[model samples]
Target: MATVTRTTRADAPERSRTEHTGGGLRGAVAAEWGKLWTTRTPYVCMAVGVGLTAVFAFYYGSIARINDEPVQAVGKAPIASVILLQFIVVVLAMTTVTSEYATGSIRTSLQWVPVRHRVQLAKAAVTGAVSFVGGVLLGVLGMAVAWVPFRGHASFETGEAVVQLLSIGTYLALVAVLSVGVAFVCRSAVGALASLFFLLAGLPFVLLGPGSEVLRKINDALPQSAGDHFMTGDGDPYPSLVGLLIVLSWAVAAHLIGLAVLRRRDA
Candidate 1:
């Protein structure tokens, strides 16, 4: 008879545990980065965003030129593009989380990582970094495209343009983080998108439309308004620093809530 050997059940769990801990946070992040690029969603989102920005920039530039707007700042030329790009960024970030849930691949992800918080952190890091870079590039591209129609109508200040580009990057990174957190909480793309839409656009409009001082004050404190003030370097109701803090606070709050939910919920 041939000799036979059987592995004990205990050995199986030990091997699994070792495999689970081997990857850790670094591995999780690498995996997330891979997932982000391997899919078509990121590419689609980026292409659509770039196309929309170019179109909007040209339109805005033409309008400014036609109106003979007096030397509008180049930094402000991309404002319209930024508004539309926010939705694109949010969709991209949310998909990172929601897509996995939609396809039931989140279970496999959890199995590989085995640490929920690490998974969340990895997703946040990847999305935030990608959004920041995209935002900066889009800002520069928007300005360049708009300048075609705004050759004589726009004023360019290197310092101001740099500040605006950096601000756009910072704002989009935070917005990406906020969208990721919301995705984890909702676990459905439509649900998360609706919630973010209200927070980023609809609520601001409703509050501002009322034309009440209290409502206006509340709107100013929202993430969208705060981001606007920070990016534009506005100092009307509050300083830029305060505006940044407000946006940061919203991002942090959403992340914490999502983390808590991830810990308690089933994958």
Candidate 2:
């Protein structure tokens, strides 16, 4: 006389590790970190960071010793080397998203964590945090090499040097986070990098055309050209803090755009 309906397993939702945020994201972050460290690209980027710092520092400091231009030692040589290495780090950061597409793991990632923004935020947080640590290490190691060649703090004024070191780390962190945001927007490494090259390399030239002193003067207020402030201790031509704020604004704008795209587009 009793008519009971049977619940079919096929219609059931997939069971996740948690109903929602409840410690799942933390576990995901931990797992993501393991993936990051075990991968070759990240460790290679770390090595490049350390190697660039040491090799370029020694080269620049040696040049300084020969030319007796100790002040320009790290500025001229080490900054270029650091920039090159940081660019590679940025590429690696971009791959955080692209790699999932390449391996077809993104579907599973999305399924496991249906809330899309949370996934992107977690990935960005992990990459940015690790990149910042790497940048800090690179700054310290480069300073060490420069100091060693200078006969143990010979040319490095202690207080000023610490300021430069912090600035170096902060710049690298911003670059890395920006790359992560770009990658999320583009969803392709090559596309994201092409866009970045335009922003960092092209924008400055376009802003400061030849024989346009007035335009160049105001445009120089932008972030890319003003990036040199960290390496230059003299009275910077542009406002250093303003440049930083501009960079932050760019990051925020780019991130919001990417978030909107992620919301509208299919994963």
Candidate 3:
């Protein structure tokens, strides 16, 4: 005699739900990734981002010998390049979400993956992963090329330089994720770009302007300041850990708010 056992959905509701959620998330991620790469925007953005980094790295290296301190050029090359490339990252991230809404594909997306949170998480994951990998490649390339000007000489500590490279890559990726969240909240490419410009470009300048010491302290908490601190190895306003936490907190808060809004609204 043989006994056969079969599990029913009601009998294992928790397990069933967990499996369903996991499957849905994977499907959503794959779908988002496929959608993202199927177009030319991501490719163009990546090319521009890395291309600009290469240009800046070459420029820095070319002038490295002219400066009184050539080591400063080596240290600044990679990070400075990334700072300029961040705008492209912002546009890429914003377009990822806004394009869907613009084409009215969002309704179909919602229909396919009814779980709004999963969709949002999938998009964020793709954006973050792509940006992080691109940033790392760009940073490494910039550093390698910048070293050409130094002729193997250095003014900065090797350990710190290595740390800064990793930090800059991380900062760029975080910025991309933050931009993705902002795009979700804005739900429009133009609006999101305006918001990103204010947050990434305008705010830092305004905060850094001649003002009270209190304003300077507040400026340290801004995302650009955090990125600058990581880039320049400046631990004055906030420690590396604190600066990362500040940026990460903003990213998390933005995503949470966007998710809540997505859940409440129609596609």
**How many backbone overlaps does candidate 3 show?**
0
- Put the candidates in lDDT order, highest first: 1, 3, 2
RMSD of 1: 4.5
TM-score between model 2 and native: 0.79
Q: What would the per-residue lDDT of candidate 3 be over residues 1-267, giving only the tens digit for each residue?
A: 999999887879888677777467888999989998999988999888768988898887777666645346366788877767888888878788899889999999999889888888888888888888888778878877777776644455678777777787788788888888888889999999999889877987888787879888888888888778867767787677888888898888888888887888757
What TM value does model 3 have? Answer: 0.86
Clashes by residue pair, model 3: none
Residue pair clashes in candidate 2: none
Q: How accurate is candidate 1 locally (lDDT)?
A: 0.91
Writing each residue's lDDT as its tens digit, candidate 1 over 1-267 gives 999999999899989988777488889999999999999988998899899988998888999999988887776867657888999999999999999999999999999888888999899999999999999999999999999898699889999999999999999999999999999999999999999999999999999996999999999999999999999898989999999999999998999899889899968
Model 2: residue 50 alpha-carbon error in angstroms: 2.1
Best by TM-score: 1
Better of 1 and 2 by TM-score: 1
Clashes of 1: 0
Evaluation by lDDT, superior candidate among 1 and 3: 1
